[model samples]
Target: MKKMLLIFSFIIFVFNLLTAQEKEKAQPTPANKVLSKYTKEFAVSLLKGVDDSMYPKIFKAKMSMETIRKGRNPIKFVYEVYSKGSTKSLMEIVFPARDKGKKILLLDNNLWMYVPDVSRPIRLSRNQSFMGSTFSNEDVSDSTWEDDYDPEITDEKGDKILLTLKAKRRDVAYKQIDMWVNKETKVPIEGVYYGLSDKPIKKIYFFNVKEIAGLLRPLDMRMADLLEEGAYTDVKLLELKELESVPDYKFDITQLGR
Candidate 1:
């Protein structure tokens, strides 16, 4: 009877050891490896669905801006953004031609302040901030993903993959960006922007993930300013339409005056 008890104890010990080994083997190490490959795929999916027809074409945006310091109703504005490539961009705010009107034109690397009372376009620097918001003309005028950045995978985990992106042109607003892509969904979960100082300038959090045009994408983004303790920016995508056959001439800087 004592010998049988000893045998039973040994069998239990061996079973526990086998269980622990299996658990260790099941750790998500392989999932991390698969995530790295999906990171590149996510980047391609985002770029491919961005409606190329919008490129070299004009699109209308109904936007509102409110001064944070003053408690006032948000100022409403109607504007058109046109883009062709990295070198060219044009923005024209329409005057009371219809519903909302305040006409201003931004062309090429310069801004043209258009006041109906003034006769000609006033040249302004691209460095000027837009409506006291974090975005500048350089940020607004940036073309698609291809023109702005070149991304490479830096690190990966079970459900997270890190990407490091470098600005392709000197005129780009940010120098580098570190993006985190979700493994299962293949979408960007977060992005960190670095400035010329090689320090983190902003961190963008993506939420409300959804599948659009057969691709998973973020519907809302919140940006935290790393320089300022409590300052942040929120951008909500109201709509995303895949357009076709946007004309090239519409995006030209020369079209701004017309």
Candidate 2:
């Protein structure tokens, strides 16, 4: 009878141990929690280019883009951008008399470009170049990495963390990205974008850190196409302000005609 009791007790102890192991497995690991926190911070920093807060907000800014190429006069454009969150945005060119009043709208996965004289807005691919610059249409618009990419901490360097991002879906612009983020600030310092073949196609550097709208962020970005020599795009932020509300019509496709 004592042996039988002992055996029963051993079974109970084993069951409890298994139950505890399962519970631990169900909970998020410390590493996963840390990754989540860092990813959120990084997403906030990325969206900070337009708005400082992660909440739903509107922003207006002046974008100055300069493109340099061999044997050609450098091209420059100035645009006024209105953005809502990281999914909707409208950009209107304000400089260079001929291109004035032209607009581009980004609503979720849809992109449209409206020329002043065109009868209707023309659909555009997100992968298309923005006015023949190194910057793609998707680059100028607002987007969040957390929504499109799965991030993992692959390595740790002194004062920096190396993050590898794989696209969660095939429609994303880049198949994968390797980013070096500042450990202290949780801001991306540099990123290398890769195509489906895992070839590096473009590189981006985030610099000119400053406080804008009461938040610290990188105000300048430089993007270079690895396949092209002596060609790159530089985007500078002239102004950024929070808006109380943006009219719903502002994001409508019909509004592009207006």
Best by TM-score: 2
TM-score of each candidate structure, all chains considered together: 0.60, 0.78
The CA lDDT of each predicted structure is 0.55, 0.76
lDDT of 1: 0.55
RMSD of 2: 13.1
Model 2 misplacement above 4 A: 1-56
Off by over 4 Å in 1: 1-128
| Shift in Å, residue 38, candidate 1 | 9.9
* Global fold similarity of model 2 (TM-score): 0.78
lDDT of 2 by residue, 1-258 (tens): 999999999999999999999977554312322344456556444424223322235778887899887788888999998888778888999988889999999888788999977899999887688998888887776666666677777667788877777788887888877777776666668888877666778899888887666666788888998879988899888878778767878889887767
Cα RMSDs, all models: 12.7, 13.1
